[model samples]
Target: MSRKYKFRSQDDLYFISTATINWIDVFTRSLYKDIVVESLRFCQREKDLDIYAWCLMTNHLHMIIGTRGRKMEHTLRDMKQFTAKRILEALAEHPEESRHDWMLWMMERAGRRMPGNDIYQFWQHDNHPIAVFTPTVLLQKLHYIHQNPVVAGFVERPEDWLYSSAKNYYSSDLPLLDVLLIE
Candidate 1:
């Protein structure tokens, strides 16, 4: 809503955080998380997105991202839209989801209260995109992103988190997402 959060320049990389409506823990399951992973992969290949660093938490995703082709806002918008629909379907069909009805109900309610989605709103509208201007800010955001799971007590080490790019940074044999290293 303010000039500070707006994407002013296409050439500048931004540190972004997109969270779920009502802070729902939709990504507690790997199935839903994979949808985001695949979407990021698609964006990297098809949309010319440059993902420098990223981390996926239970409810929010943080990334230091730039793009060579598409507008940063558009790339994020498309990614969120596709992931929302696909993850909702996965929630509907997931046999082991204990909170299936509740999660969908919350998102639907949020949608009604929010501006965009007609029925259900998965990601909260504001991306909180902060332009990454300096090497210091980039490193700070990068550390914050990778250490999210560790700070949240989800894992003992940043690389222990299966869904984060820390694995890729830490020489993990198989990371879920491939990131362009800034270091």
Candidate 2:
């Protein structure tokens, strides 16, 4: 097993990207997307997590966040794990899932490839966290995060993406985190 790197300080904002296992398109369905939103909401409400930015792609997520307590690492871990379970369960129960067996098989193969994870892992374990130490870097990271959906061709405008915080940033009617808006 590889040594896991400890997360940075809880009080400092960090830019993070966590991908899906094998880069599978897990968030293509509303059920899976809801799992991610609920996970983020749970983190903010229960774990004292301050989510500054977020965008949910088909198979991954980018976030800018900080924690008010020392359990930010655990909060991220638990959020991903919990969402994975829920998302997997949704896939299993989905009547219209055309690629169900294929996805499950791929997840199983990935678990086998990983050294110690006994179950089929659904998320990439390594989260790339870039510490947001300056206002300039913070705005840069925010732009990068919010521009993801637009760059992916999922929406014509960033504010049109329902699963992203870009709408909030643009003063649109979307339910998103109360991000620290930067002018």
Candidate 3:
């Protein structure tokens, strides 16, 4: 991991993107996306996470996040671990998941290639965190996060994406997770 991507300052906010292992398009399903949303909500409520903005895409997620009580990196690690576990469990138990076996096999193969993981690897290890040091940089990242779905052709507008905080920014609709709107 590069020093630039590591969370260095405890109090500074960061823009981060976390991707699925092998960019597997794991979040094409709503169940997996909901797992991520709920896990982020749990982190915000109990793990001292301050979510400024977020967007979930087909294979990755972007967020501008800060921390209050816990270390940002540690809280994020817990969130990823918990979300991965839950999503894997859901994949195993989902009766209608046509790609369940394939997804598990891919994750298991990824886990074997990685040294730290015991069985499966859902999320890639690197968060690719960029420090949001200035208002200009913050707004740039905020736009980047919201524009992801548009760039991906998932929606015509950023706020139309239900899994993102873009709607919260416009007060268009309530988002899946509460966000601390940037001013």
Candidate 4:
């Protein structure tokens, strides 16, 4: 845990990115991606998480988030832990997951290299959090988050990415997860 990326202020919004261990394309499957979406929804509904924007890519996720009641760090920790466990379980139980064995091996190998992991590590330790202190920076991060899928050639337009808040921003359809619209 690097102090540099630690959430220091509870009220301030932060842009954070959490990657899969070894950058494995774990989220290429809809089951894994649904796990993340449901986890975020859970955090928002039960854990006082305030999500302004989010994007889920094949291997990583980015979000602009803050906290209202609980500490942001704690909420984030719970989200990551819960999601990791659920996603790993889903992978194990998924009958059609062709890369299940290879994915588990990679995660297990990465987990063994870490100190606290008991079996496997799903998400990388560092979130690479950047405090969104200014409106300019917030917009920049929002643009970056929405454009990730486009840059990766997953979509021709940012709003075409169903896993992001860009749809909520650009159209009337609700986002995959609830989002706090930024003004």
Which stretches in model 1 have alpha-carbon errors above 4 Å? 1-4, 172-183
Model 3 / residue 25 / CA error / Å? 0.6
Candidate 3, superposed: residue stretches over 4 Å from native: 1-3, 172-183
lDDT of 1 by residue, 68-179 (tens): 9799899999999999999988887885689988988899888888765579999988888899887778778988999999899989989889888887777745432333
Model 4, residue 51: distance off in Å is 0.3
Q: TM-score of model 2 relative to the true fold?
A: 0.89
Question: What would you estimate as the lDDT of candidate 2?
Answer: 0.83
Candidate 2 per-residue lDDT, tens place, 1-183, comes to 454454657767888899999899988888789989988998898888888889999999999888888477788899988998888889878847998988889998898988887768899998788888888898888888888988888888888899988777778443232346542
User: lDDT of each prediction vs. the true structure?
Assistant: 0.87, 0.83, 0.88, 0.87
Clashing residue pairs, candidate 2? none
Model 3 Cα displacement at 122 (Å)?
0.6
TM-score of 4: 0.91
TM-score of each: 0.90, 0.89, 0.91, 0.91
State the lDDT at 82 in candidate 2. 91
Highest lDDT scorer: 3
Q: What lDDT does candidate 3 reach at residue 9?
A: 92
At residue 76, candidate 4 shows an lDDT of: 79
Predicted candidate 4: what Cα RMSD to the true structure?
Answer: 3.4
State in Å the error of residue 138, model 1.
0.9
* lDDT digits (tens) for residues 86-145 of candidate 4: 998898788579998999999999899989789999888888779999877988898899
